[model samples]
Target: MTKRSTPSSPQSRGNAPRKSGGGWPIPTPGDVLCYAYLWAREAAQGQEEGLKDRPVVVVLAATDTGNGVRLTVAPITHSAPDGAEGAVEVPLAVKRDLGLDRERSWIVVSEVNGFLWPGPDVRPLADGSPFYGAIPDWLFLRMREGIGVHAGRGRVRVTKRTE
Candidate 1:
């Protein structure tokens, strides 16, 4: 009979002592997610007006019971400045337009139409929540909401059904 080899240990598998890449390792998935979220939130607050012609990353939460998925602010790389209010929770009216009625759903923003709306109604995700809700400001952006296209990264793509 042939002999079987033993499986590798966590340490041997390079996963035992998970570090934040302080030096010996690299940032973890959790770290990236948190960083991306903060960056999006900050971007939303910097502008006095709504987002237009700006590319944003859409963040989708893995869990359904919690805050659920989120759409990141444009650029997907800008970090939120300290002392700045966290991303404004999405406004309520925006959610209704986007057809988000449940907590478990993907978030998305697109440019297939080639323009972002001037500004739309906004509402908070929840009471006292700092996260800003969706506000489609570009006309093209509005049309792209349900249009099919490969999302850049960190953004969610939802397709709207045509009757």
Candidate 2:
């Protein structure tokens, strides 16, 4: 399990609790999670975005560390940014399986982050929510490969088709 140091002064926004260990179910790889993200300000760009609650795809399986589970995830956005490199377009089948309402969405593989689950920062998608469901194993593997390639980790070569 990878260890991440806690920020000295963690930013808090919206109704998300500021501590770890909640009753929320620990999300596994392939699960789409919904949470409030306190995106850091880009001072040079003169921008301050706060409390964006949205769906993110769990790219790696959660590792329980007694206190809370650690998760690596990539953001799922309805709008695909123009010329944004390393954005993997989510297929219609996978989107339908995940119960996403958007006609199209992309997994931002380059924007992966390690977060503590059942913590103030991350939580499961609400019951009956459109963003609640798991992607198929093939899609999950493709996402993992996308992340690996984007991060300059060696590419994952898969030749088998699950169809």
Candidate 3:
């Protein structure tokens, strides 16, 4: 996956106060992040394809590691829900608040992943100026609720949520 310039030194990335002795941006719950995910393809020899760069919402608060922060994120997809089992629809207002260009998108709660901040596979959104922002608190709470319900079904593994 291609890498963008590293997120502007932590202080300018978000409104959240910088961590003491800051190293990486401390992503808060509801923050939207850009990431490149590798999706597996149904092919011989377990071939896979990259999902390329996309926006993902930070569902869990970040943990500051001295080296970098780790975050749990849910990918935002433009696909129709069609009653998909674990898809959580992102409301228009929430999308607007997050500055997402797509009019309609779904947070694939079942596909959450842990990412290291400012890493090659993930970084803050910066096309010209920093566009990194957070979704509304209410929307984030609803998504977390959906994730909990989905998790309780025992379909998504605990390791996927924790690791």
Candidate 4:
């Protein structure tokens, strides 16, 4: 998790963002970005683009050489989880603050995707912000715990997004 300095550093990563230099919004943990997330199953089926664009949480982000950032993001979905996916419910209050819809959503920590920042699938808000907003610290920690638990059990499926 080597962090790099930026003008608009990420609160979660401590060294992320360069909003003024603008291109890709600096990635930070807990920041929810709208992206076309390619699932492992889809990748295995030879699919490249995500079936649909969805909100994904930046669970892990590390600066790569030359301004590029590598990220591991978990999908947020309205589907009710069965508990095996290490899904954590987004507190209604938190959702409201982020301006998300009233529909219940869960951060699916058991599954994640890896990609470079500003990848083709990553899309910004209409206002050009990198993310909608960040989830609370407590909630992030819970998601982290789920990631750890699933990783320990070898259940976390990481689908790599390639050019």
Candidate 5:
């Protein structure tokens, strides 16, 4: 667990959740959580879940019609931007603050996934912590802008989780 507001963390073995139990915290914008992010390509190929669990940044959160919070999140990966992919580098200080690996990482804004809060894809870290913690406001704003632009350009792909 992060020792923050949440009970614990999940990558879920790489993302893993059945449901939120025991007063599970609601996700907020700028939160970096380990999740099973089904990429657009995977969805196109008919794969329902992400290949592996990984850190993802919450870019948007809105109250769904069912009164559950629906979240739109982007992946954080070590891969550098190689082309038209919209991305923002994760500053070393930020990564250090979140207790993430030392490897260089980026928040990929061009791809995202949507799911209800504390859905089945959420997973705790092996130690049972629930998140890496939240990103800075400035960083999240930048990511949100990127997401908006990509989404407007039809470059963003949002895979809604089935479960």
Candidate 6:
């Protein structure tokens, strides 16, 4: 996957803050590809304005031997207009079972860190308590051969939403 340059140039002055938290590198293209499944859904639903400023988990899966499933989970920092950070994880046994010898193996987002923001810096507080929050217009609930995308908008507590 191609590496995305950090938004540090003077030209990026108007860009939203690079990050709200520290300790991680920006999202990679592969990370972005994992989320492509969501894009497909969002586009299909004809919704495009939502999804910014949220933590999202992208999950991908592939079939394995009988009675088992292959799964991967990734934690992604969703920035707006075009920036994100991500961390990918998979079970060692599953990896071997699925022959995941390359980085292109399946991955998914299990949780989100914060609410999806508008643009990049703004966070709208809920008018009521325990805001149910908004689901991205684009969410991949299913995958082809048990592989697809999902959007949680923040660090998902459960890495694998399902087996």
Give candidate 1 regions above 4 Å deviation: 1-13, 16-20, 27-32, 39-44, 47-103, 107-163
**Could you give candidate 3's per-residue lDDT for residues 17-107 as a string of tens digits?**
6642224446667767666654322212253323477887777755556645666777788887656667778878666655666577887
How much does each candidate deviate from the true structure in C-alpha RMSD?
18.5, 12.2, 7.5, 5.2, 6.0, 18.1
Report the C-alpha displacement of residue 90, candidate 2, in angstroms.
1.4
Local distance difference test, candidate 3: 0.60
> Between candidates 3 and 4, which one is better according to TM-score?
4
Clash count per candidate: 29, 0, 0, 0, 17, 30
Candidate 6 Cα deviation (angstroms), residue 163: 22
Which model, 4 or 6, shows the larger lDDT?
A: 4
Encode model 6's per-residue lDDT on 73-138: one tens digit a residue: 332322221212222333344334322233333233433222221112222223211111112212
For candidate 5, give the lDDT of residue 142.
Answer: 79
Q: Which portions of model 5 miss their true places by more than 4 Å? A: 1-22
Off by over 4 Å in 6: 1-36, 40-85, 91-93, 104-106, 110-163
lDDT of 2 at 50: 23
Which window of ten consecutive residues has the lowest lDDT sum in model 3? 1-10
Say which prediction, candidate 3 or candidate 6, comes out ahead on lDDT.
3
TM-score of each: 0.19, 0.63, 0.69, 0.83, 0.83, 0.19
For residues 1-163, write the lDDT of model 4, one tens digit per residue.
3222322223433444353234545666877888999988898999989998888889888876865678899998899998655699998887786668999999988889998887888876676655767777778888999999999999999998885
lDDT of each: 0.26, 0.55, 0.60, 0.78, 0.78, 0.27
Candidate 2 ranges with C-alpha deviation above 4 Å: 1-20, 38-50, 62-66, 82-85, 123-131, 153-163
lDDT string, candidate 1, 45-149, tens digits: 563333432223222222224332223232222333232221223334544543344332222333211111111211122332112223344322432333223
User: Model 5, residue 43: displacement in angstroms?
Assistant: 1.3
Q: How does candidate 3 fare on TM-score?
A: 0.69
